[model samples]
Structure formats: structure tokens, C-alpha cells
Target: MAPLIAVAHGSRDPRSARVVTAAVAAIRARRPDLDVRVCFLDLNAPSVDQVIDAVATEGHSTAVVVPLLLGSAFHARVDLPGVLAAARARHPQLAIVQSNVLGHDHRLVDAVRDRIVAIGVAADDTRTGVVLAAVGSSDLRANDRTRALAAVLAGDTRWAETTVCFVTSTEPNVGQAISLLRSRGVERIVIAPWFLAPGRLTDRLEAAALQAAPDVVFSETIGAHPLVADVALDRYDTAVVAAARTRLSA
Candidate 1:
């Protein structure tokens, strides 16, 4: 089997890289026969280019590149592809196949709920209010998809209310979202991060939420959840098939 390079949007926080590294490790555990590796886009070690070069150097003729991103934003659409194109130019013998991103997979929603549950926030608790927090983007539509997740969680239970707020680059920030939940008489609020890993943005969200309402608590981030690893592996499997077809046609 060709190597599976799981690429993450790197962060200066070592925790972010650790989470990704561990998650890819889990993928390896699940499929010991598969060659799974982790790399970063920036601010972390073993960057995408480095990994691609290593894969080519390792004598792999073709490899699958699975994006460990939650949103199909600029990094997914532009940055990664640009790097892959360069890698192809540098190694004409190696075929690099980029897989689909780990976008709002419904299983990920389950992972968020799992995090909330881990924090002792019952899914059916009516007094509880949930703020689905994410690192917002400048693209409004990207923000909208994240914002819409609030309802998907609310619909799952009788929680007082569910609302979304951005940690940056958008309206209804952490404080505003808490106030909106407060207006609805939700005294117990929990900020459930929709992120795969915690970083500076998550710290900012926590500080702001506490400032708005000190009583509010936060669930753990969606890091290394078995479901996330499952989704990534699924994306890799899909890309493998797609890549094979492309090669046959070419």
C-alpha cells in the first residue's frame, strides 16, 4: 500500500501538533499494514513539501494525501493543491492524489456531542445551552456552515438553546453568543469546540466566554476522537479508488 500523508493546518501551539500526531498514530494502530504519516501546513514540523519529498524518495510511485481539515476553505482549495503541484513537478515519477477534506461529516457532530458528554453536560439537559465555537473564516459561507451547526446540535436534544459564534473574523462572537443564550434563560452554558485540536484561537474563545459569563464551562475540543480518525481513513480509502481510476485513464 502507498503511504497515507495526513496533513494538518499547523499551529504554533505544540498541543495542536501533538493532537494531529496522535490522531495519525491512531490511524496507524487501526491499520498496522498501512503506512500512515502526519505532516503540517505551517508553524509545525515535517511540512507537506517535506513529507511529499520523503514519500517520493522512499521509492513510492503513488501516495494518497488526506487533508485533516474540518472546512474546505482556502488551505484546502489553494494552499494544499499548490504544494502538491510543486511536488509533482519536483518528482515527475511520483503520483500525488489529494483527498477530500474532513468537512462537517455528521460523524464529527457525534464526536462533538461526545466531547460535551465528557464534560458532564448531558445531551438531554434542558437547562444547558451550547455554543458551537469554531475558528471563523473571512468567507461568509464558510462561517455560515459552521454557524448552522448550532441547530443540528439543538435538534438532538432539549438543550435550552444552541447557537454558534466565531472566535474571529465574524459577528456574534463568544460573548455575543453567550448573551443570546442568556436572553433565552439558559444559565448553564457550555462552549463545545468544533475544532480537531486546541490552539490560540480556542484559548481566546475560552477567555471571552468566561468574561461574558464566568459560570460558563467548556467541553474538550474534538481531538483524536476515534470517529475523526475513522473519517480521515474513509477519505483516504475514497481517494485511493479515485486515484486508481485516474491512473488507469491516463
Candidate 2:
């Protein structure tokens, strides 16, 4: 069986790391025979290089890299590719497959929507507002993907207003987003974080939203949700299928 590496945007928060660790464990439970390891792109231990070396050392000639990121942003495009390139050079005989970034999949969207409902926001009531808060990205494309996801939830919940806000690099940071919703006559505001971890930024986002509107509700960060685990496994499966096709054509 091929080795699998789960890569995440590491966090200083131990809870964040545990979430990813648990998610990988769930994946392993489903496929007990496969070799699986978890690592981070940066800001934590077991870096991408470490994971690659470990896989090669274990006699695995081919490995799949599954990024646990929510959107295809800088890390997914540049950082992840650079890590794979370095690993490729170090282990020339090893075959490495980089899978797609986890972004806006139906399963993930459903998870967020479920969280919103759990926050006491009536699904049928059209008077409430929802703000899909995320750690912003400089990549416009990535930000757009998050906005599209918000639209999906908006369509399903039929909230009075659905806006996408960021912790950085975009307009209407959480506070302003809440104000916008209020201006539009929304009765209640729900801030749903699109982050996979509870880090400093996530704390700041919640604080700001609370400061702006004390009545606003902030949902839990999206980490290790069963749906998210499913999405990660789906990404790995896609890479496996792609690797098989490449070998067939070769």
C-alpha cells in the first residue's frame, strides 16, 4: 500500500494540532492497512521535509500529500509545490502526488451550515444574518472561493443577509461585516469561522465581533469535523486515481 501524508497549516495552539491529528486517525481507522503520517507546512514540528524523509526511509517509493487547508491559496499553490520539489530532489526514486486543496466541497459546506444551525439560527427565519469569517488570503481566487461557499449556505438557509469577512487582507473585517448586516435590518448576527484551527487570529476575530455586537454568536472553528475528514480522504483518493492513470499512460 502507498504511504499517505496529511499536511496542514500548523498552529501554535495544541488544540489545533490535536484536531488534525484526530482527523488523520479517523482516516486511518477506515483504511487500516495504509501507512499514514501527519505533518505541517510550517509553524510546527514534523515539517513537510520531515514527513517526506520518513516516508522514503520506510521503503515507500510512492506517497500522496493531502493538504488539510480549506482553500487553494498561497500555501497550496507555492509553498506546497516547493516542499514537494525539495522532497522529490532528496528522494528521486520516490513518486510524490500532490492532491487538491480542500475547498468548498459539499461535505465541508454542509458542516459549516450545520454549525450555523446549531448556534440557534433558525433555518427558515429570513431575518437573521450570517457572516462567513475566514483567515483571508492575498490570492483573490482563494477569497472568491470562500465567498462562493458563503453564497451556498445563504441560498440554503435563506438568511436575510450573507456576507463573507476576513481576519486579514480583505474588506469588512468581522466587525464591519456585522455592521453591514445590521444596516440591512438583520435581527441577529452569526459569525461562522471558516478556519480549521483556533489560533490567535481566530481569537481576535471572535473578540472583535463581540466588541462590535455583544449579542452576536460565534460558532466553533471548523476543525476535524467528520465531513472535513471525509473531504481529506476524498482528496487523497483522487490523487491515488491520478497516479494510477499516469502510470498507465507511461
Candidate 3:
């Protein structure tokens, strides 16, 4: 059977790798026979090259490279493709399919919503406000994704307001966002992290929240949620189906 490789934007934080591994494990539960593996783009073991090389060495002709990113940013657009190109050159006969980043999936939205609910926000509390925080990317299109995600969550009646915030690379960092929410007369604010795991940026975001708006609460990082696993699987399936169609067309 073909192998499925889940690729993450690696970090120095071991928790990041652990979370990605857990998500891969959940996906494996749905496909017992097929080989499922987790690899990183950088800063961790089993880099994309290593994983693809192992797959090729094991005699797998086809492998799906699924990126565990929230949006199409530099890593998704440039870094991943570069890695895949190099890997393909090393093994010219290997068939590789690149998947899309996880962008605006309902499961991911639900996971964020769940985190908001977990932080003592009531379903009917109109006074409650939310700040969806993310690691800012230099890519404008990628940064827009945070706003898009906030809009989706704001539509729910439970959340009176949802604002997008970033830790870097964009305007209205978490601190500014929290102050803005408070200034709008919101009684309570919950800063929801749009990250896969707790990293240095997340730590800074939480610290800034405490300093800027001591009254506001911050939710836990959205790490290894089962819903995320589901979204990853959906992206993988979509990529595989698209690849199959392309082959037939050729």
C-alpha cells in the first residue's frame, strides 16, 4: 500500500512533534493497513527528505505529502515544494502527491470553538469577546486566513464578537487586540490560540495577554485535537483523489 506522510512545520518545542505524532496516530486508526508517518520541514527528526527516502527505499512507489499547516504561507507555498522537488530529484521514479494546507475547515473551527467554550465562556453571554491569535506570517494571503477564521466563529450566536490577532508579522498583535476588545465594553475576553502546539510564540502571546489585559482569559493551544486529525485526513483524501484524477487525465 502507498504511504501517507504528515509533514509539520517543525519547531524546537518537543511538544510540537508530540502533538503532530498524536494526530498521525489518530489518522492511522482509520487506515490500519497503509503506512502512516509524521515528518517535519525543519528543526526536528525525520525531515521531509529522510521520510521520502525511507518510503522510496521501502519500495513504495507512491506517497502523499500532507502538510499540517493552517494556511498557505511561505512554508506551504515555498518551503514544502522545495523539499518535495529535491526529494523527487533524488528518486526520480517515485510518485509523490502534495496536499493542501488545512485552511478554514469546519472541524478546525469547531475545535477552536470548543476551546473557547472550555474557558468559562457561556453560550448566551453576549458580553463575552474572543481574540483568535495566530503566529503571524509575512505572506498577506496567509495572514488573511486568521481574519477569515475569526469571521466564521463570530457568526455563532454564542460569541458576541471575534477578532483576529497575531503574534508577529501583522498588525494588532495579541496585546493590542485584547485592549481593543476591552475598550469596546466587552465584559470578558478569551484569547484563543490558532497554533498546533505550545511554542515560544504562544508563551509570549499568553504573557502579553496577562500584561495587557489582566482581566482577559487565554485558552489553551489547539494541540493534537481529534478534530484536527480529522481535518488532516480529509486533506489527504482530497490530495489522493486529485492525484488519481490527474493520472487518469494524463
Candidate 4:
């Protein structure tokens, strides 16, 4: 079987790497025979290039590169493709098939709901407002995807209201979202970080949420959840199967 290379958007915070590592471990636990490796796109060690090079050196002719990203933003669209192209040029013998970004999966929604519930918010709490906080992107469509996810969560979890917010790069910043909720007479607001791991952005989101409303509840980052491992494997399998079909057709 081809190795699974899980690539994440690295962070300066060490906790972020740890969470990603844990998620990879979860994947290993689920499939002990599969060879799974973790790499980062930036701010951490063992970059995507390094991982690809290492896998090639280890005698793997083909491998699956799964972007552990939640949206089709800059990193997924531009950076990852650029890296893979460079890696392919450098190692012509290695067949590195890239997978799609992890976007808007129901398992992810369940993960977010699980986090909110862990923070004492009931699933049917119609009075509690939710602010689905994420690291904002320069692309409007990417930000819109976050809003769509918030809408899905609102409907699925039966929260009174769920609004989208960003920690950077876009409108409706965390403070603004919380204020909007407050204006809507939602005294009990919970800020759910739509992140797979804890990092500087999560800290900023938490601080902003507390400043906006003293009694605001903040959920933990959705780190190393079993559902994430499932999604990673799904992406890997999809990529591998597609690559096989393409090769056979060629």
C-alpha cells in the first residue's frame, strides 16, 4: 500500500504540532498496517518537501499527500500544489498524488458539535448563540464557506443562532460576531474555534471572546478527534484509488 502523507498548515505554537501529531497517531491506531507520516507546510519541522523526499528515498514509488486543511483557501489552492510540483520535479520517480482539502464534511460538523457539547452547551440549547470562529482568509469564497458551516451547525445542533467570525483577514471578527449575538439578545454566547488544533489564533480568539462578553463560553480546539482520523483516511483512499484508475486508463 502507498504511504499516507498528512500535511498540515504548521503553526508557531507547539501545541498545534502536538495536536496534528496526535491526529496522525489516531490514524495509525485505526489502521496499524498503513504507513502514515505527518508533515507541515510552514512554521514547523519536516516540511512537505522533506516528507516527499524521505518517502521516495524509502523506496515508495507512489504515495498519497492529504492536505489536512478545512477549506480550499490559499494554502490548499496555491501553496500545496506548488510544493507538490516542486517535489515531483526533484524526484521524478516518486508519484505523489495530492488529495482534496477536508471541506464541510458532516464528521467535521459532528466534531465541532462535540466540542461545544463538551463545554457544557446542550445540543438543543436554543437560547445560546454560537460564533464559529476560524482563521480568516483573504478569499471571500473561503470565508463564505465558514459561514455555510456555521449555518449547517446551527440547523443540525438546534442552537438559537450560529454566526461566522474570523480571527484575521476578514470581516465579522470575533468581537464583532459576539457583539452581533449580544445585540440579538443572546446573553449566553459560546465561541467555538473551528480549528483542528490549538495555536496563537485560538488564543487570540479566546481573548477576544472574553473581552466581548465576560460570561462568554469558549470551546476547546477540535484536536485529534477520531472523526478527523477517519476523514484523513478517506482522503488518502480517494486519492490512491483515483491515481490507480488514471494509471490504468493511461
lDDT of 4 by residue, 156-229 (tens): 67677899999986889988998898888886898888899998888888887788778988887878889998
* lDDT, model 2: 0.85
Looking at model 2, the pairs that clash are none
What's the ranking of the predictions by lDDT, best on top? 1, 4, 2, 3
Q: Give candidate 4's whole-model lDDT.
A: 0.88
Q: Rank the candidates by TM-score, best first.
A: 1, 4, 3, 2
lDDT agreement with native, every candidate: 0.90, 0.85, 0.84, 0.88
Off by over 4 Å in 2: none
RMSD to truth, every model:
1.1, 1.6, 1.5, 1.3
Expressed as tens digits, the lDDT of each residue in 108-156 for candidate 3 is 8788888777877876789999999988878787777668888887656
How far does residue 161 in candidate 1 sit from its true spot (Å)? 1.1
| Global CA lDDT computed for model 1 | 0.90
Report the number of the highest-lDDT candidate: 1
TM-score of every candidate relative to the true structure? 0.97, 0.94, 0.94, 0.96
Model 2, span 82-193: residue lDDT tens:
9899889999989999999887787877888888887787788788899999888887877777778777877656779888999995876988899888888999888988
* Angstrom error at residue 34, model 4: 0.8
- Name model 4 segments beyond 4 Å from true: none
Better of 1 and 4 by TM-score: 1
